[model samples]
Target: MISVVLLGSGNVGTHFFKAIEKAENVRVAQWFSRQIDSIKGYKNKTAITDNLSELMEADLYILAVSDDAIATLSSALPFENRLVVHTSGSVNVHDLDKKNKRGVLYPLQTFSKGAEMDFKNVPICIETLDKKSYPILKEVATSLGSPTKRVNSNQRRVLHLSAVFVNNFTNQLYRIGHEITESEAAEFDLLKPLIMETAKKIQTLSPYMAQTGPAKRHDKKTIEKHLDLLKNPEHKAIYKLLTKSIQNTHGR
Candidate 1:
């Protein structure tokens, strides 16, 4: 059986715990959190503790904490020369304490507290200098129904930056769209289908080829009207910047 000790009580840790619970041949040996109350629910199911000295020896110790806390936490682990991994997209696999086998098990998706995600559909990115632990991580991903990929630190960094543009920046644009609709006393939900279709289109078509907008078409009048409609200076600036970027991309 593959034993995993999850160290963190945040959204990623919580989601991983649920995934590992239903996975076969894998069991959680213990959970570590500074605040025991955060993970008290799992007390009856598995060992939970705030003390690092009480940490159990496991095949893999997965640190699912914030990027900033990863290095410090891994360095403070009591044991050494064991398989230890972190679930971060941007953080380096080498960030883990060198005393242990370092690896990255980055799931390329946004996680929310109490949000249910289908792991089977999520992509898991793994990177490690020690290939010995690859099988264990691969098996865990397979059991959780996630697709696995080997991504080195440099590649993972680029992927994280792209994710920021595609996911984070896009989400901000959605919020802006909602604000605009709300200002006009319109239902933001009305744009849901359009948003969904925009996402779906990129799955089958190149974004450049799929591009269709006033900016892409070089419709200066329409773009001007959109900029004029925005009451917020920040929104107008963003609109102009995006419009100019699109025009330059398409040679409009």
Candidate 2:
């Protein structure tokens, strides 16, 4: 059995803990946080400690802390040469302290506090400086039911930035759509099908080919009407920028 010491109590840490719990051959050796009360429920399931010095002997240590904290936290670990990994998409694997064997096990999915994520669909991006450490991370990924991909630090950074465009930016657009609908007392739920269909289309068609809108066609009249309808200066600016971007991209 592979023992793991999980360090952190945030969304990624909680979700990862839940995923690894279902694994048959992997066990959480300890759940560490600054405050023991933060992870009270896990106390009965595994060793819970705030003291870095008292960490149990484990085959792997997974740091799910903030990107800035990874270096200091890993550097403070009392032991060296043990397999230490972080669950960060953008942070370089080399960013972890060199005192221990450093690696990354980035789960390419946005985590939320109460949202339950199916590990089967979440891709685990693994990286390691040592060839021998690769199998250990791959085993953890497989055990968690995640599809494993070997991503170098640079590739992971670009992939993560692309995710911001795909996921984060898309969600912000949804918020703007919601605001527009709400202002007119229209049901925002009415757009669910359209949103879902837009996403579904990209599965089979290239996004450029799938694009269909007034902006895509460079309908100057409709674009002007949209800009006029937007009362917020910020919203108008966003509308103009997007419309201009679409026209420029399609050579309209």
Maximum-TM-score candidate:
1
Q: Give the backbone clash total of model 1.
A: 2
Which digits, one per residue and each the tens of the lDDT, describe model 1 over residues 1-252? 888999999999999999889888788989999989999988999999999999999998999999999999999999889989999888888788899999989989989987888898789998888888888888878888899998889999999999999999999999999999999899999899999999999999999999998999898899888888999999999999998899999997
Estimate the overall C-alpha local distance difference test score of candidate 2: 0.92
Alpha-carbon shift of residue 225 in model 1 (angstroms): 0.7
* Total colliding residue pairs, candidate 2: 0
Relative to the true structure, candidate 2 reaches a TM of 0.97
Which portions of model 1 show Cα errors greater than 4 Å? none
lDDT of 2 by residue, 47-102 (tens): 89999999999999999999999989988999988999999988888888898888
- The CA root-mean-square deviation of candidate 2, after full C-alpha superposition on the true structure, stands at 1.0
